[model samples]
Structures are given as structure tokens and as C-alpha cells.
Target: MGSQELEEEELVQMVRDFIESESPSSPSFSSSQGLGTFNQQPNYLTLQEILGSVEDTEDEVHQKILKYLRNKNTAWKTTNLKKWLVMRLRMDGYDASLCRTSWVTTYNCPGGDYEYIDIMMDNDENGGVGRLIIDIDFKSQFELARPTTSYAQLTDTLPCIFVGCETKLNKIISILCTAAKQSLKESGLHVPPWRGTNYMQSKWLSDHCQKVQPIPRISSNNS
Candidate 1:
């Protein structure tokens, strides 16, 4: 079994917590609506409204925002590791003013602490490097990109993210995997693909995925 290493910067772990809290309550999920003014309604805030109050935000918030944006209009259906990452957030920062002007109407992108994240892309779909001002995304428990492999020649190091639950990043990874497999299948390469599992994930694919590879994380206890 691969041993989990302790993190150096303690804040890295805390960012995960913050992202999750962002979407603490689902918009459609509401208490029982009965006779007179019966239960409370789920609080659904617009993306711009969310960014406005970013003096502080929970990690869940980031998760929700990403999730919403991704599935919002199927725009995220074809994102790559390089494009759909936090880099996307950086690009959106360029039009902070325009975004604010468009806020009441078309400001759908989630807010970021732009002072820390540098905007270099001309569009939100573009990707590049940006400074991480604050460790304000994804929780440690729900951390994305567990180290798996190292590409350097000087030293040997272990890498690979753990597959346990429905971390937003994992779900995003799965979406990429699904997209890749779909492409391979279209090319007739997935006819006899290696089997994966649905072992131990926090969130899983919908019921429609009939012939998915058994990613050990979501399948058996062979870990």
C-alpha cells in the first residue's frame, strides 16, 4: 500500500474545506412546502452575487461554482486537464470590471481573489499559469490530483491521487476519463478495453454509464 504523506503547508488542506462550503445548500432542495408559509426555501445565489461577498468563502463554494459552470451549458464537456483547471478562473479575472458590469445579467463566472490570481488569457476557455494568491480551492480530504508519477531525472519520487470519495476534482477527472473513453470508443478502440471498477468513490457516474471501466477506487477492496 502506498503511504499517504503529510502535507507541508497546512493551509493546502484547508482550501479544500473552503471550496466545499461554497455550495452547502442545493438550490432546488427545499424543506416541505406545506399550507401557509410552510418551510424554508433553499438559498440559491447568483454567481456574481457570490463573487461580491468573497471576503471569505468555503471550499465547497468553489466546488459548486465549478460544478455549475461545467454542467451549466455543457461548455465543460470538452475541457482538458490544462484548460478546465484553476487556470480558467484566472482567465475570467481579466474582465473584472466587465464582469462586474455584466454581473447583474451575464456574470456567470465564479469570483476569485484576483489580486492573487493573475489573468493572462483573453477568454475564459483559454489556459495558462497563474499565481496562487490564496489556497482557496478544494479541500484536502477532497483534494484533486493525488501525486502519481514524477517526470524529473534527478530524483525518484512517488505520485498519484487517492481514489476515495466524490471530491470535485475527482469528478472532473472522471468527466475527462469519460470523454476520452467516449472518443476512443468512437474510434473503435474501446470495443475490448481493459475493465475498470466503480469501487470506492464518494460520487459516482449516473445510471446511464453501462460499460464503464472499473476504476479500483470505485469497485473492489483490492487497495
Candidate 2:
């Protein structure tokens, strides 16, 4: 088989093994057990119960995500991160919705140019107010740019959950820290009060970085 096919097969097997390990075995009842015994308050597992048993599933999936990005032959791009996150959040019982991709908005500045947010999440449908905007900074393109002239200048319309991420964990933290500082300076804009506060701003950025783990290196055997 080709290397790509082989890698896919390996990933499939790995996921299968993980699920098998997490699944509970069928309960066995004695032959003499009566229907009355079965009806005597059988402890049936709920959806939450099953999911709680696999609480580490999220971490495992995150590890796999990192592995995929670390692969040299993988065609995955920064935008794929948003797609993966949306799906994973849903899987983890979060009410996540992809509001837009490459959402373009115009700047009323001197250039009157346009900019885009990589991804936006509308949590309003899920009983939450406001939106969550994410900007993936894979190669420091956004990080190295002039914030004064970039979309950072358009904070009024930006979502309070605005976050920028890099592939590396440390870099992701650094970029978010810088973004938080900018948010503090521009807090006078029409943003949510929590987002405007320094403490909450730091929490928002730090929390995002904490959720993002570094990609693991693929072993030579897998290669």
C-alpha cells in the first residue's frame, strides 16, 4: 500500500482500539434471575454516564489532531483547525456552530480594504449571547502584521471570543497574550463588558492556549 493509505489504516486501527478500550462490556445475569429481579431497579447507563466513562476521549482526539498536523505529507492547513474544532466541540456536547468561514468584512479606514476572520461560532442558538471568532495564525502571518492597520483596528464589530492560534503551544500562548494586551487598550469599543475587563481578557486568551495542545511526532514505524 502507498504511505498515505498505510497511515490512514494505522489511524483507523488506533481509533478502533481506543473505542474498544473505552466501551463497557455487556452485563451478565444468572439463568435463575427472574423478571422481577431485572425490574428491581436496573442501573441503566445514561448518555452522560457513557460519555463520562470516556472523559479522556477529548485529550486522545486532541493528540491525534496534533499528530495529523505534524505529518509532513499531510495536506491539512490552518483552516482545517477550525473545522476540526467545530466537530470536536459538538462531539464533546458543546453547542458549537460554524457561523462563517473566511467571513469578509470591510474596513472603513483610509484604504477601505477588507479582512477576514478564519472562523466564527454563533453560540446564540445554543443559549449563549454573542459570537466566538477565531483567527488561525499558522505561520505568524497575522502575528507579524501591523495591528493598527489590520483587522485589529476593527474591534467594534469583532466577537468577544476573538482568538488567534499558532501550531506550536508556546507560540499560540504568545500570540494570544499580545492579542489580549491590544484588547485591553481598545476596551472602550463596543465589546462586552467581560471582554473589556483586563482579568477576563487574560483569562480568555490563556484559556484558549490551555485547550490547544502541541502536535505529537509520528513514529518511524508508522512512517
Candidate 3:
């Protein structure tokens, strides 16, 4: 193999070994111990938990969101889109809401706020309700100005829109941050604080976030 090809292979192996070492002994979620309400402290997830098969409900919800997007007639601004989806999902008997997360500039990372949609649904997993995070622009979060071939391939696997639970997102951030660090080092670039794992985690998992349930729109006849 060429020198560059050898380097890419080495990078892949390094990531694999790291993830293997980080794999947790217990699964992230199960029927018996379902992912509880968002108010509960989240369980830390590992490589194995993320690599496992997608839960049936997660897949179903994913498809449903895709269908909703596909059927929409008008282009939507992010704020309006989130509000509409929140109302739509709520009308469908799903406990959905618009969530906004903000962070302060820390020594390690910069501060920022983000908006996304989430649903608390009992996805037929033995009547367990789980919070599913929905990001319309999931893939873009991991984009790099100039990425190594190996790193690019890793990111290409991410869905344009992400609809999954905290456990799944945790593992993704861990893997991507590591890849991004190596890619930046190879390119002789400084890794930005925003691209770090902690920063990315705060976008979705921070306790300081605000979750707002949209007030239902009333018709004129109601007055």
C-alpha cells in the first residue's frame, strides 16, 4: 500500500481499538430497563451499545419523520419547522416538544445555543417511554473544513437527519470527536473547541436546556 493508504489504515485501527476499550459491560437500553423520562439521569453508553441493532421503535420513528418531511409542501425555516413538527407530533398523541440548549464559554470549549425537536414516546418496548432526539441537520455538525479520506468516510455514514436516543448520540459524538482530532493533527490544523466531545454533548444532553411544548392553535370558532 502507498504511504497515505498505510496512514489511513493505521488511523482506522487506532479508532477501533479505542472504541473497543471504551465498550461498557452493560447495554445502554433494554426492555426491562427502558430509557426512562428525560428528567432521569441518562446512562452512559459505550461502543457496543451504539453498534447494536437499532431498536424497532427507533427505526419506526425515524421512518415516520422522513415521511413527514417528504410530504410537506413548503420549504421550512428551522424555527418554524421545529414548531410545526412539535405540534404535529403532539397532535398524533406523541409527547413532542421544541428543545433549546445553551452553554457558557468554558476553558475547554466555546458557548452556544442550539434548537432541535424531541419526542417522548412509548415505542412498544414493553410500555417504556424514551426520549428521541431529532436533529434536522445532523450530518453537518461533524463536517470539517478539510478532512482526511478516513475521517470523511466515517462521517459519510451519518444520516442527514438524526433521530435517536441519548445513548446513540453519546457514542457517535465520542467516535467523531476522536476521528476529527486525528484528522486535524494530520492536516496540521488546530482542533476547535466546538468540535470536541463535550461541546457536542452539550448541544443535546445538557441539563440547562429548556424544553417548550407548543401551545395548541385554537380556531376562530373557539372564541
Which structure among the candidates has the greatest lDDT?
3
Best by TM-score: 3
**lDDT (10s digit) by residue, model 3, range 78-159:** 3356666676666656677899999899999899998888888775748878888987667668899899866765565565
Model 2: lDDT to the true structure = 0.32
Q: Model 1, range 5-38, lDDT digits (tens) per residue?
A: 2231233233333334334463211111221321
Superposition error at 163 for model 2 (Å): 3.9
Model 3 Cα RMSD, 1 decimal:
13.7
Better of 1 and 3 by lDDT: 3
* lDDT of all predictions: 0.25, 0.32, 0.67
CA lDDT of 48 in candidate 3? Answer: 28
Q: Which whole-number lDDT from 0 to 100 does residue 72 have in model 1?
A: 38
Off by over 4 Å in 3: 1-52, 75-79, 123-128, 217-223
Clashing pairs in 3: none
- Measured with C-alpha atoms, the lDDT of residue 19 in candidate 3 is 33
- Pairing residues by index, what is the TM-score of model 3? 0.70
